[model samples]
Target chain A: GAGVSQSPRYKVAKRGQDVALRCDPISGHVSLFWYQQALGQGPEFLTYFQNEAQLDKSGLPSDRFFAERPEGSVSTLKIQRTQQEDSAVYLCASSSHIDSPLHFGNGTRLTVT
Target chain B: SQKIEQNSEALNIQEGKTATLTCNYTNYSPAYLQWYRQDPGRGPVFLLLIRENEKEKRKERLKVTFDTTLKQSLFHITASQPADSATYLCALFKYGGSQGNLIFGKGTKLSVKP
Candidate 1:
């Protein structure tokens, strides 16, 4: 793809249900990132991947949140036992390199009821 | 604790005027700072980046100034137009941290009136 692509533009799940969001970054990009944005708030870091390596998962709010980029291209963010507080837009971004500007996806708006 | 603050109120300016937005941070040293523009229901688009060692940067009608000592950055849009109306965000890359760990301010919404 010419830019980062995210799937499931919007999702509504009941509390305690599990959900998965997908991201397909720009071709050959070396860095991929995941962020969660609440209404009226800036995007907050969730995880980062350098190719297939999960270099940082320090920002994940809890064990219920998990992300992986196994092949260094497509990534998935899965939330288990979702809570109402988990409702937010999940954004995916990729950069050509570690120091380059990021290209972001339109994001998936998740609403946990 | 580290904190980033941006103008809490929306800025309204007439077209052809210059729009200036402020971003301030505390309790952390950032290697670089960046500015982005976002529209409603859309993701933020990258604009400019300034390193700590650099004082300023410019791209076309956009100008960004970074002051590490004061932990502040100012973003200016010259000859603003109604189409330029959007939320501008300020992000900081922490020193010695991965780029994916960028910290962002809540952003300032700008409205340009014709």
Candidate 2:
């Protein structure tokens, strides 16, 4: 696909379990971002990467949430000891430039029961 | 802390009428504002962008106006149609040191009835 691609469209995890979400950004895109959207709410920023460098992770809810864009192409968001509050749609977006319009993937919906 | 607000309540309008959505912000002025449309179960798609220097920008039937002094932006859709019904999100572009992030409003759901 030409747009950003995300895997495991839906995931149901038991509380205290771990899960990892994957995102493949558009080819040659220099910027990638992760956002978490709760039901009926807008997406909240989680982290941002410029190629292989993780520039920002300020919006992450807690230390349990971590993300990495290894080799500057594919990225992964991992949650350890997931809690019920971790349930949300995780969205990934890519842009060719720092200030360009973002192209977003449909997103991965994670439910922690 | 910066805050963005959009009407949490849905906006109902008849087809063929014009639909206007408002977005307001406080605590900081942004360099630009972006509007996006999101359908059910889909990701947000970029609609229009208005810079601080430019008061208004238009593309096809979509128009966006930015008022830096007022810290508000208005999105207008002319000739509303059923297909135009969706949740519209307003984002403020905040620049800090070397990185920029978009702070988004909760979004306003627009319903165009035929």
Candidate 3:
């Protein structure tokens, strides 16, 4: 792929609903990352993966948020029991290697009502 | 704890003028700093990077300066155009093992007027 791609560019979820967002990273990109951006704020780190191995999940705000990049090419972020505070843009990015510049996707804008 | 700050207010500048943006950090000694440009409804694009050892880096109309001693960085756009209107973000990467995660500032919006 030329760039990272995310599915369902916009989503509106009801409170207590579960939502799943998907990301397709560029071909052969070994490093993938997830970030959450609130309105008018910078994107905050959520999780990161090196190939199929998820190296860091410390940035996830709570247990309700989960991300996985199994098989390395595609990734998914699932949120359980969505809350109003979970409304934000979910960003996905991919890099060729560690320390390389990232290529980002348009992101999925999640609105929890 | 570490924190990165960028001027939250929007900056208005005339076309062709050099636009300067600031990024400051505290309790961090990053090995590399990166700048990215983001437009509304689009993801951020990488602009420039400055290493801790390098004081300045330039790519065409973009120049970035990093001062580890001051814990600050400056991004300058030479001969700015309205096309350059976007939000600019500054991020830091740790020296050793933490390579994938990037700590980012809130970013400043630059609006260039013709």
Estimate, for each residue in A2-108, the C-alpha lDDT of model 3 and write its tens digit: 88999989999999999999999999999999999987888898989999999988889999999998798899999999999999999999999888988999999
Residue-wise C-alpha lDDT for candidate 3, range B16-54, written one tens digit per residue: 999999999998688799999989988899999888999
Tens digits of per-residue lDDT, candidate 2, B16-56, equal 99999999998878888999999988889999988889999
i-RMSD of model 1 (Å, 1 decimal): 1.6
Assess every candidate by TM-score: 0.96, 0.97, 0.97
Query: Candidate 3 chain A: minimum summed lDDT over ten consecutive residues — where?
Result: A38-47
Q: How high is the TM-score of chain A in model 3?
A: 0.98
Clashes of each: 0, 0, 0
lDDT of 2 at A109: 96
Candidate 2 TM-score, true structure as reference: 0.97
Candidates' C-alpha lDDT: 0.91, 0.90, 0.91
Give the clashing residue pairs of candidate 2, or none: none
Off by over 4 Å in 1: none
**DockQ of each model vs. true complex:** 0.70, 0.67, 0.69
